[model samples]
Target: MSIRRAAIWSFASQYASFVIQFATSVIISRYYLLPADVGLFSIALAAAMVVAIFQDMGISRFVTGQPEMREEHLRDYAAVAVGLGWGIAALVAAGAVPLARFYGEAGLAKVMLIIAGSYALFPFSIVPSAMLTRALDFRRLFQANAGSALAGAVVAIATAANGAGPAALAWGMVAATLARLILVMAAYPVLPRRPASLEIVKPMLGFGGSSFVISLSGAVGMRCQDLIVGRMLGVSATGLFTRASALAGQLTTLMVGAINSVFYPAFAKKRDAGEDLAAPYLHLIACNTGITWAAAIGLALAAEPVVHLLYGPNWADVAPLLRWTALAELFFVAMPLQMDVPILLGRIKPLVWINLLDTFITVVILVVASFWGLEAAAIGRILTGAIWLAIYASYIPRLVGIRYSALGTAYLKSAAVALAAGAPLALSRWMSGAGAEMGFISLLGLSLAGVFCWLVALPLVRHPFWQELRLALSHMAKLRTTQA
Candidate 1:
C-alpha cells in the first residue's frame, strides 16, 4: 500500500488497459467504418474533453495533495465536486446546439450533449478514486481500469460490427466510464455521505484554484491542435492527426500518471513536514526521462509497420504523424516532475501562469499552422511540446534548487540514445524497399529489424541506466534473500 507499490500496480493496469484499447481501435477502425467516421468521432471526443475540463477544478488533486485527509473532508469535497460537475455539464449541454451550429454540424450537438452530460456522473466518482490513490491502494485502480477496458472494448466491437460507426465510439467511451465508476465504487469503502454545503466548498476551491487554471489552460492547449485541424483542414484530417496523437498521448499519460499518482502524495507529505526532499525528486526525473526516451525511440523506429499492422492500410497515412507526435512524448513524460512537483510544493501561482503562457502560445501556433494543413499542424504540436519542455527545464531548477547541469546532462544522453536507436530503424526501412508492400511478412520482418537494432544499440550509449538496472536487480535479489 506504499506509494511505490501503488505506482507499480497503476503502471501494470495502464499497460493492460492500453493493450485492450489499442486492439479495439484497430478492429473498429479497420473492419467497421470509413476513415471519415473515425474523424467525426475524434471531433466528438475532443468536444467531450473540452467540456470535461470545466467539471471540477481539480478538487481531487487538492484532496490527494493533502497531508492528512479525513472522511468528513472527503464527503465535503465530493459534494462540491459533484455540484460543480453537474452545473458545468448542464451549462455545456444547454449550449450544445449553438456550439454545434457555429461549427456547422448540427448533428454534433446531440453527441456533445451525451458526452458532456457524463461530466455530471464523473465528479461523483472522484472522491472515492482520490481516497484510494491517497491510501496508495492502486490494486483497486488496476482492477477497475483493466475490467473497464475489457468490457468497453467488447461493447465497442459489438456496436462497430453492427455498423453503428461513430455511435459505436460514443457507446464504447460511455461503457468504459461507467465500468470504471462501478468498479471504483465497489472497491472503495467510503462513500460521499453529505449534501452540498458552502463550508466543504471553500477550502477545496481555495487549495485547487490555481490547479483549476492550470488544468483549464492545459486542456485548451492540448486540444488546440484538434480545434485548429477540425476548423481548417476538415474533420477527416483532424481525425487522422487526433488518432495518431492519441496513441502517443496514451504512452505519455501512462508514464506521467504513474509517477504523478505516487510522487504528488509523497511530495506533499514531505513538504508539509518541512523535509528536505531533493533525492526522491531527482530520482523521479531520471527514471521518467530514461523510460520515455526508450519508448519514443522504439516507437519512432517501428512507426510504419506498427501503423500498418495496428490500424490497417487506410490508416497508413497516420504513420508519419504518429512518428512526429511520439517525440513529444519524450518531453511530456517529464511533466510530472516539472509541473506536479511545483504544485505539491505550493508554488501554484507560478504553475498557473506558466500554463497560461503555454496555452497562449499553443493557440497561436495551432491556428497559424492549420492554414498549412495536417502535416504542418502535426509539426506544430511537436514544436509546442518542445518549447514548453524548454521553458520548464529552464525555470524549474532555480525554483527547486536542483543542479540543472546534472538534469541537462541526463536529458542530453537520453536524447542521444533515442536518436541512435531510431536512426538505424529509419535507415533499415528505407533500404528495405521503403516499406511499400504493407503485407504481414513485410511488417513482421520490419518489426524484427527494429527490435534487433534497438536492443543492439541501447546498452552502448549510457552505462548509468544499465547501472540503475543492475542496482534494481541487486535490490530484488537482496529482498528475496531476506525472505528466504
Candidate 2:
C-alpha cells in the first residue's frame, strides 16, 4: 500500500481504539474504580514502561528501516528481540517488589507482576509487526491493533466492574498483548531461528543501543510526573493527573500519532531515494498544527463541561489540568515527525542528546513544581513544552537546513484558526456566567457551535490545510474509481 493509504488505515484503527478506550476509561473511572485504584495502576504501568523500553530495543526500527534483509538476518533480529523481551520481563518481575515497597503500595507489586507477563509475549509479535509495517501492509496491522484494543477494553471493563481494581488493568494489558500476538502470527507466520554467528547481533546492538537510550530517556521524561505525583502527592493526585494527561493525549493521538506510525518508514524510503525532505516536512507541520491547534483550543475552552460530563463531579479538578495539557499538545503536534526525520537520516547521536536534555529539563521542572500542587505541575508541563520547542528550533534547522521562518509561517494560519474557533466557546462561557451551571446538552451545543465556527474560519483564513483536505478527498475519490 501507498504511504497515504497506510496512514489512513492506521488512523482508522487508532480512531476506533481511541473511542473504545475512551469509553472504557469513563466507565471504569466513574463506576468501577476509585482514584486510588487508577493511580496504583498508572504507577505500576509507568514503572513497567520504563523497563519495557528495552523489550523491543530498536529491533522493529532496524527491521523497518533496512532496504533489504535475508531470512537469516530476520531470524537473527527476532532471536535477539525474544531474548531482550524475556530479559525485560524478568527484570520487571524482580523489581516489582522493590518498586512496590518504595511506593508503599503492596497492590502495585501484584499489578507489576501481572503487567510483566505481557512483556514475554511481546517478542512473539514484534518481528512480524515490523515486517508488515515495512511492507506497508497497514490493513493487517489495523486488524491486529483494533482487535486487541477491543478485546482489552472488554476485559478491562468486565474485570473492573467485578471489582478487580488495578489488577484488571494489568490483566487487560496482557490480554491485549496476547491477542495482538495471535493476530500477528496469523498474519505473518514466520518462526525465528537462533543465530549461529555473533556478527548479526553486533551491528543490531550498536544501532539499538542508541535507540534504547533514546527510548529510555523519552519514557522517563514522560512518566516522571506520574512518579512524582504518586510519591509526593499520593495516588489520588497521580490518578487525576494521569486522567488529565490521557484526555489531552487523545486529541494529539487522533490527529498525528497514527500518521507518525507511517511516517518513519515513509521518510526512510524518501532518504533511500535521495529525495529532499524539506517540502514534505514543512507541509506536515502546517497541516498538523492547523488541525491540532483547533482541537486543542476547543478542548481547552470546553474543559469544564467536558470533564464533568464524561467523568462526573469527582473529576472536576482534571479540567484545568486537561486545559494546560491541551496547550502543551499544540506545540507537540507542531513537529509531529521531528524524531522520525532525524532517525531516518542516521543522525541518532544528536537526537539522543536532545532526549537526555528533555528528560533532565522535564524532571527538574516537574519536581520543583510538585511542591506547589497538581495544577502547578500541569503548568510546569506547558512551560517545559514551550522551552522544548525553542530547543527543537535551534537544532532542527541546523540538522535539516529548514528555515525557522518557514516553520513560523506554517504556524501562522493555524494559530489564527485556533483563535477564531475558540472565540465562540469563550463567548458562550462568558455569557452564560463563568460559574453558571450548564447541562450536557448546553455544553454539546456550544461544542457544535465551536466546530461550525472553526470550519467557517478555515476558508476565511485561507489556510493551506483546506487545499490539502480537498486534495485528500480527490485522491480518495480516484482510488475508489480505480478499485471499482
Candidate 3:
C-alpha cells in the first residue's frame, strides 16, 4: 500500500479510538470521579508506564526497521518480549505498594496492581502488531485497535457508573490490553515458539538495548511531572495537570501521531532501498507543522469552551493549563520525526545521548518549578521542549543532510499559515470581548472560520504542505472510486 493509504487507515483507527476514549474520560470526570480520583489513577499509570517501557525492549521497532526480517527472527524476538513482559509485570506488582506509599496514596497501589495484569497480555500482541505494521497492513491493525478501545471504553464507563473510582480506569486498561491481544492474535496468529538459537538474540539486543535506554529516559521525562505533582502538591494538582496534558496531547495524537506511526516504517523502507531522505524529510516536517500548528493554536484559543463542553465546569481550571500545554505541543509537533530519523539511519547512540540530555533538563526544570505550583511546572515543560527542539535542529541537519535554511523555511511558512488560520478567531474574541465567557455556538463558529481561513491560506503560503494535502485528497478520491 502507499504511504498515504497507510496513513489514512492509521488516522481512521486513532480518531475512532480517541473518540471512544475521550468520551469515556469525559463521562468519568464529569459525573463519576473527582479530580483527586483521576490524579491517583494518573500517578499509578505514570509509574506503570515507566516500567512498561521495558516490556517491548524495543523489539517492535527492531522488527519493523530490520532490513532483513525472518520467521526465525520474529520468533526469537517474541520469546524475548514474553520474558520481558512477564518480568515487568512482576516488578510492577512487587513495587506497587512502595510506589503508592511514596505518593501517600493507598488507592494508587490497587490501581498499579490492576494495571500490571495488562503487561502480561502485552507480549501476546506485540510481535503480531509489529508484523502488521512492518507489512503496512494498517487495516487489520485498525480493527484490533478500534475493537480494543471500544471494549475498554465500555468497561471503564460501566465501572465508573457503578462507583468503582480509580480502579475502574485500571480495569479498563486491562480489558483493552486483553481485547487487543485477542484481536491481533486472531488477525495474525503467529505465536512465539522455542527459540532455535541464541545467535539471533545478540543483534536484536544490541539494537534494542540502545532503543530501550532512549525510551526509558524519554518515559522518565514525560512522567516525571505526574510524580512531582502527586508528591509535592497533591492528587488534586496532579489531576488538573493530567487533565490538561491529556487534552493537549489528544489534539496532537489526533493530528500528528497517526501519520508518525506510519513514517518510521516508511522511513525504514526508504533507507533500506538506498533512497535520498532529505527532500522527504523536509516535506514531512512541513506537512506536520502546517497541520499540527494550526490545530494546537486553535485548541489553545478555544480551550475555554472546549474544556467546558468536554469536561464540564468543574474542570474550568484546566483551560489555562491546557493552553500552555498546547504551546509545548507546538514545539513537539514541529519536529515529529526528529529522533526517528537518526534511529532509522542507525545513529542510535547520539539519539540516546540526546534523550538523556533532554531528560536531565526536563527533570531539573520540572523539579525546581514544582516548588511554585502546577502552572510553573507546565511553563517549565514549554521551556524544556523549546530547548530540546533547538538541540534537535542543531543535529538533524547534519544527520539528514537537510540544511538549516530549508528547515527554517518550512517552519516559518507553517507558522505563517497557522497565524493566518487563527486570525479570524482572535479578531472575533477581541471584538466580542467575551473571552472565556463565549458560548459553545460562538466558539464553534470561530473554530470553523479558522479552519476555512487555514484552507484558504495554505496555497498563499507557498508551502509544499498544500501540494501534499492535494495529493492526500486525490488519493482518497481514487480509493473511493476503486471501492465503488
Highest lDDT against the true fold, candidate: 3
lDDT tens per residue, model 2, 1-484: 8988898898888898888888889988888887788899999989989888998888888888876656567777788889889999999999999999999999999999998998888898989999899888889999999899888999999998888998998888998999999998899866777888988778878889999999999889887778889999999999989998998888899877787788778878888899888877777777788888988988888888788888887777888898898888877777766676778788999999998998899899999999999999988888899888887877776677778888787788899888887887889877876532568777777778877887787788787788867878899899999999
lDDT of 1 by residue, 1-484 (tens): 7665667787788788888988898888888876677777677667667666767687778777777666766777776777778887787678778767766876667666766655666776788888877777889989988998998899899988997777787777778878888998898744555656666667777877777788888888876567667778877787798878988887776655566567777777778888876666766776676666766766765677778777778888888888888877777676456667777777889888887888898899888877887878777777888888878877777777778777776677666655655665567666864553446675566556654554555477662455556765787899999999
Which pairs clash in the backbone of model 2? none
Please, what is the whole-model Cα lDDT of each candidate in the order they appear? 0.74, 0.85, 0.88
List residue ranges in candidate 1 displaced over 4 A. Answer: 193-197, 254-257, 436-464, 471-484
Better of 1 and 2 by lDDT: 2
RMSD of 2: 1.7
Best by TM-score: 3
Q: In candidate 1, which residue pairs get closer than 3 Å at backbone N, Cα or C atoms, i.e. clash?
A: none
RMSD of each: 2.7, 1.7, 1.3
lDDT of 3: 0.88
Ranked by TM-score from best down, the candidates are 3, 2, 1
